[model samples]
Target: MTTPSGDPTDHEHWRRPADLEPGQPAPRPAAPAAPETPGYQGPPPTTPATTGWRPPTVVNPMAPRQLPSQDQDSIDADERGARTLTYGIAMVGGAVLVIVICLLCSRVLF
Candidate 1:
């Protein structure tokens, strides 16, 4: 069968499985034919223009300002307090969870 473009190979005849007899083998669709026209070849590459080496210039001339000093002892104490608070909260949460589980088990059993 010819397609709308008038290409004969584009719509080669192939019988459906239902159309064949019970013992008859099914036919494969024909492979597409190669194009008559040559494949596309894009524009050729060109080398880029180059510039000579240039000396680097300093953007800022002023000396960098110093950061404020931190009190190591105070920082250590704050870290210790945060760690203790985290552990206390975790313990309280675990105890509440255990109490809830025990209550649920007692209710189910009784």
Candidate 2:
């Protein structure tokens, strides 16, 4: 893709192949060849101890993310407001439905 001014750029056009139909699945990728282990080739060891076992240490990929206090406050406020609005709508709808039913009953009884 290039800018409207017709300048040449690095981007290449990506689209469906001309030969393939729209609904057909894309061609499957060739499966990767299995890796070979060298030197010690015997029946695989049954247990970790057989292969000189060592306890593995866990490492976190990334530190825990925390929003700033202001952001957290804003998010909390938004959540509260949404909950309040939902509850208010439900209450009003229920009240209106009950009033309509009561009025109908009064007209029928009188």
Candidate 3:
């Protein structure tokens, strides 16, 4: 492949080297000055009046608690009903899938 007229490796193509004299070094620019500002003072401290307000109490999740006897019976009954419903749906879906497979097989045979 042919090389371009302006080769990057050639020092004459560089801006800094071409501008500076052979013996003299380039002059350094002055550092920027920081702006003057007053020290930061945070917002004034506040103390809320306790006339009627009260902080919320925290509950311990690990603590063992007892449920009312009637509520426990109701919960057990609900779980049983849900399990019966899930089993009934699964059985109905399986029967439908079997019937569809038999119909397809019969059609192919005939």
Q: RMSD in angstroms, all models?
A: 8.6, 19.1, 12.3
Predicted structure with the largest TM-score when compared to the true one: 1
Ranking by lDDT: 3, 1, 2
| lDDT, candidate 2, 30-94, per-residue tens | 99998986877789868545566667769748877997556878899999999999999999999
Task: Give per-model TM-scores.
Answer: 0.50, 0.35, 0.40
Judged by lDDT, which candidate is best?
A: 3
Model 1 shows how many backbone clashes? 0
TM-score of model 1 vs. true structure: 0.50
Which consecutive 10 residues in model 3 have the weakest lDDT in total?
Answer: 10-19
Model 2 TM-score on a 0 to 1 scale = 0.35
Q: Model 3 clash pairs?
A: none
After TM-score superposition, the amount by which residue 16's alpha carbon in candidate 2 deviates from its true location, in angstroms, is 62
Q: In terms of lDDT, which candidate is stronger, 1 or 3?
A: 3
RMSD of 2: 19.1
- lDDT (CA) per prediction: 0.84, 0.83, 0.84
Model 3 residue 62 distance off true place after TM-score fit, in angstroms: 18
